[model samples]
Target chain A: MSTAGESGKGVGGLSTAKRRPGRRPGSADTRGEIIIAARKIFSEKGFDKATIRGIAREAGVDPALVHHYFDTKDGIFVAALQLPVEPAKVVPLILAGPREEVGERLVRFVLTMTADPEAREPVIALMRSAMTNEQVVVMIREFLTAAVLNRVVEALGIPPVNMEVAFAQVFGVILMRYVLRLEPLASIEVEELVQIVAPTIQRYLGGD
Target chain B: MSTAGESGKGVGGLSTAKRRPGRRPGSADTRGEIIIAARKIFSEKGFDKATIRGIAREAGVDPALVHHYFDTKDGIFVAALQLPVEPAKVVPLILAGPREEVGERLVRFVLTMTADPEAREPVIALMRSAMTNEQVVVMIREFLTAAVLNRVVEALGIPPVNMEVAFAQVFGVILMRYVLRLEPLASIEVEELVQIVAPTIQRYLGGD
Candidate 1:
C-alpha cells in the first residue's frame, strides 16, 4: 500500500491522475492496488467499518477515482473477492452435467479452486472476513447466494436448507483443511476428499 | 470481571485473598470466577499471550489461588472449554450403540450441544478463537484430538483421516449454522439437520 495518499482528505493528489476524456482505460494496476488496500482494511476493521476513502488512501489513489472505478464500497468488495473462476460461471457448469454427479462437481470445484494459492485469494480474504465480522458474514452470505449458491439450489430443485447444509459441510471441510491446516484433512488428496465428501453433498442436494 | 482488582500491578489486593490453610476449599464461586476471567482473557489476547496473572486480576483473586486450582495456563484453558457433557463420557456411550448408528449418535450429539445457548458457549468461544488465531487453532485441534476426536476414531477402528474428514464436515456445519448464521443452515431444525447430515457421517464412519 502506498503511504503517500493523505487520509480523509478530498481527492487531493488524485486530480492530476484523473481519467481524461478518451484516455486509455485506467491501468489495472490501480485497481489491483485498491484491492490490496481493501483486503488489508477489511480484514483489520471489517466490512462495517472499512471505508472506501480509507482504502483509497492506502492505495495512494484519489477517492474520486475509487468512486469512479468501483462506484461503491460493496462494488469494490465484490471485485476484490471475484474468484478466478466466477462461481456464477462455474456453478452452472457443475449443475449441467449428470444430476447424480452434482455433488462431485461441487466438491471438486471447491477443492480445485482452493488448491492453488493465487486462485484461493478471494475466498481466503472473504472467509477470513466472514469469520471475524458479523457484517462481513452477511455480506459474504449475500454474495454467495447471488453469485452461486442460490442458483445451484434453484437448478437442483432441492430445499434451500438442504443445499445450505451441504454447502456448510463442504465449507467446513475447506476451513479445516486449508485455513486451519488440520492434519489428515489438510494432507488428504483432493480426489480422496471428493470421494469422501461428494456423496454427503449429493445426499443433501438430492436425497429425501 | 471484578472491578475491585486493579490492573497491571504486582498482585495488589490478591495478597489478602491468597488461599489459607483452612480457606474452606476455595469456594466454587472463586473457581468459577477464575474460569470466567480466563475465558475473557484467552479470547481477547489468545492462548499465547494471555497471562495467568491477568486472568487472576480479572477474577479479582490471588494469582496463587488460580495456580492452586488449575495448575497451569493449559489447565485453565481445558477447564474453561470443558463442555457440560464431557466428550470422554459421551464418546463411549455413542460407540456402545450399534456400530452402524455411531454416525447418527455423533451427529446428533454435536447438533444438540450447539443448539443450546449455554452449552454451546465453550465450543463457540474456542471456534471463534480458532478462526482468528493460528496458535488457538492448534490448541483447539490438540484439545479436540485429546478430548474426543481421536478416541472416537480409535473406537470406530476407521482410518483416522476419514474420522477427521467426518468431523470437519460436521464442524463446518456448526460454523455455518451458529458462527456465520448462513440461511437455511442457520434456521434448519436439529432433527432435520440430523436426518440430512447423519447419513453422510455414517458413510464416512462405516461405508466403503
Candidate 2:
C-alpha cells in the first residue's frame, strides 16, 4: 500500500491486481482494485465530480463489477474511505459506560482514531469530502445522527432533542481539535483535552 | 426599496445599470454592487469555485469594476460578509461589563447576530463556505483566533493555550444552538438559553 505512489501503480515487485493467495474463494480482486482506485479518484476529484466509470477505468475493472461490489456511489464511497469501524459498534461503547463516563469515552475514541498515522488520512479525506460535497455531507450527518447520536441518546434515557445537542457539543469539539486543528487545542495533550471537554459534554448529555 | 420588489427587480430595486442614489458618485455604488454580487456568488459556488469574473457577471459590471472597488477576491469577501465589527468592538463590550456578565454578553452577541432573519442566511453561508474553502477557512480561523479568542483570553488574563479549549466549549454551544439548530437548545427562549449556557461560557472564559 505504501509502495503505491502518485501514478496509482504499486512500486517495485508489487502487482497492482494481485490478491492474497489464501483469501476467501469467492471474493474478487476487482473489488479491492475498485476501492483503491476510488479512493485515489475521490481524493483527486472529490465526491461530486468523480464518476463511477472513471473509477472503473482507473481500477482496470468493468463498471458492472464496481456496482456488483457496492450498491451505490455512496456504498463505493463508504468502502473506499475504508471506514471499516461502523458507528454502530463504537456508539454502543460510549453508551454502555456510565453517563458521566460517556463523554470521556467519546473523546478518547475520536482522539485514538484520529491520532493513528494510518487512520488520520482517510478521516481527513472523509471530512474534506464532506465539507465540499453535499451528498457526502448528508451521508456523514445521517451516519452520525443515527448510528452514533440516536443510540447515545437512547442509552442515556434522554430526549432525542437533548441528545442531539449533546452530540453536537461532543462532535464539535472533535472537529475543532482534530479536524480543524485549531491552535493550542490541537497541540494540547489528549488527557487534558478530554478532561476539559468531557465534563461539558456530560452536562449537555445528561445534566439539568 | 419596498416598491422595488413590486417592480420585479431582485433585492435593492436598482437596475443592474442604474446606480442607486444613496451610494457615492463613482466608486461607492460599484463597491456595493460588487459586494452584493460577491455574496450571491460565494454563497452559490463556495469560495474556491467563485471567481471575480463570475461576480462581475452576476453584478452586470465589468471585471475591472470589481478590482477597482475591492482589489482582490478576499477583500471583496470580507466587505461582502460585513464582519466589520471585529473583536476590538466585541472584546471591550464583553470585558467592560462585570466579569459575571461576560457570558451573557457573549451569548447575546452570537445569538443576536444569528437570530436576525436578515443576517442569518449570510452568516450561515459564510460558515458552510468556510468548511470547504481553505482561504475562507483560514480567514475565519484567523479572525476567531486573533480577534475573538485572543480578546477573551486577554480580558480573563489566562494563559493563551487555555483559550483554545475554552473556545471549543463556547463555540460548540453556539454551533449547536445556532447553526445545527439541535432540538431543545433550538426551542429554548433566549433568556432561558442564556441562563443555562452563560455559566458554562463564563467558566470557560474566566472561571476555574
Candidate 3:
C-alpha cells in the first residue's frame, strides 16, 4: 500500500517513476500489490463506496492498469478477497461432473482449496475477520452472493436458503478443519471427509 | 472477578466476611462470580494449568464451595465456557427422542440456545476468541470432546470422526446464522433450518 498517494490526496498520485500505465501487465507482484491495496480500501470504505480510482491510487498504479488487470469493479473485489479459486473458473469445475456426484465433487474441491496453506490463509482469514467485523460480513455476504453461491444456486436450481445451508455445512467443516483445527476433522483424509459430508451436501442440493 | 485474592498471593484469601464455607449454596450471583473468575483463570493459565483452588481464590470463595458448586474441575470448565446447555444436561436431551429425530432435536436445541442474545453472546464470543487464540481452541476442543461429542458418539455408536463431522456441520450453521449472520440462513425460521439441517445431521449420526 502506497501512503504517497493517500497523503498527497486526489488523482495525481505517487511518483512519476512508479506509474506504469498498463506497461507491466504481466507483473505478478504488481497484481499482488493491487490486491493488497484493494483489501485495505474495501475494508475502510466497504464494497460500494470503494472505486477503481481509489484502489489504483492506493496501489501506486494508474486506474487504467487496474482495469487492464481485473476488467471490472467486482473482479477487483474478488481478487481483493482472495477466494480459493477464480469464481468464473470454479463454477464449471463444480458443475462438470454428474448431478449425483456434485456433493462429493464439491467436498473434494473445497478440501483441496484449503489444503494449500497459502491459498487457505485468506479464505480462513476472511471467515475469522467476519466473526468480529460487521462490515467484513457484509462484504463477504455480498461477494458470496454475487460471485460464488448465487451461480451454484442458479445452476442447481434450488432454493437460495437451501444453498446457503449447504454452504453453511461445508463452510462449518472448513472452520472446524482449518481454523479451529479440530482433531480428526483436521487430520482426516480428504476422501474420508468427502464420504462423510458429500451425501448431506448432495441431499441439500436436491439430489439423493 | 475479585482482584483482591489474585494480588494477595496465598491461601488466606479475601475478607472473613466474604468467604462463606459452603454457606450460600443457593446464591446465584456468587456462582456467576466464580464462573467469571474461572473464565479469566482458564484464559490466563489454560485448561490443564488452571486449578479449582485458584479459581476459588479469584472468586473470593472457599475451594470447598467450588467443589460443592461444580462437582469436578471439568464441570467448572463447562460452566465457565458457558455451553448453551449443560453437557451432562444436553446429551440426555439430544438422546431422549427417536433416533431418526435426533438431528431435528439437535438443530432445534442449538438454534434455541443461540436465539437468546444473552445466552448467545458467550458462545459466540468463545468461537470468536477461538479463531484468534490457540489456547482457547484447545480448551474448547477438550470441552467439546468430554462434555458433548463423546457422549453422543457412544450413545449412537458412530465413529468419533463421524461425530466430529456432524458437529462441524452444526457448528458451521451456528457460525453462519449467529456469528456471521449470513442471510437468509441468519433470518430463516428455526423450523426451516431444522428441516434443511436435520437430515444431514441425521446421516452423520448413522441414521437413515
Docking class of 1: acceptable
Give lDDT tens digits, candidate 1, residues B152-193: 777777887788778887887887788778787888789888
Stretches of candidate 3 above 4 Å error?
A: A1-33, A48-54, A57-62, B1-33, B44-54, B57-61
**Candidates sorted by lDDT, descending order?**
3, 1, 2
Q: What is the clash tally of candidate 3?
A: 0
Clashes by residue pair, model 1: A172-B172
TM-score of 3: 0.81
**Estimated TM-score for each candidate:** 0.70, 0.62, 0.81
Reference contacts recovered by each candidate, as fractions?
Answer: 0.65, 0.34, 0.62
Per-candidate local distance difference test: 0.73, 0.63, 0.76
Candidate rank order under TM-score: 3, 1, 2
lDDT of 3 by residue, B73-179 (tens): 77888778775566787788779978888888888888777788888888888889998998888777777776688899888888888888888888788877876
Model 1 per-residue lDDT tens digits across residues A22-113: 32234445666778888777656665577888987888777766776666666677677775665655777888878888889889988987
Q: What fraction of the native alpha-carbon contacts across the interface, defined at 8 angstroms, is recovered by model 1?
A: 0.65
Which candidate ranks first by DockQ, i.e. highest? 3
lDDT of 3 by residue, A62-167 (tens): 8887876777777788666766566766777888878988988988888877888978888888878898998898777777776778898888888888778888
What's candidate 3's DockQ score?
0.58
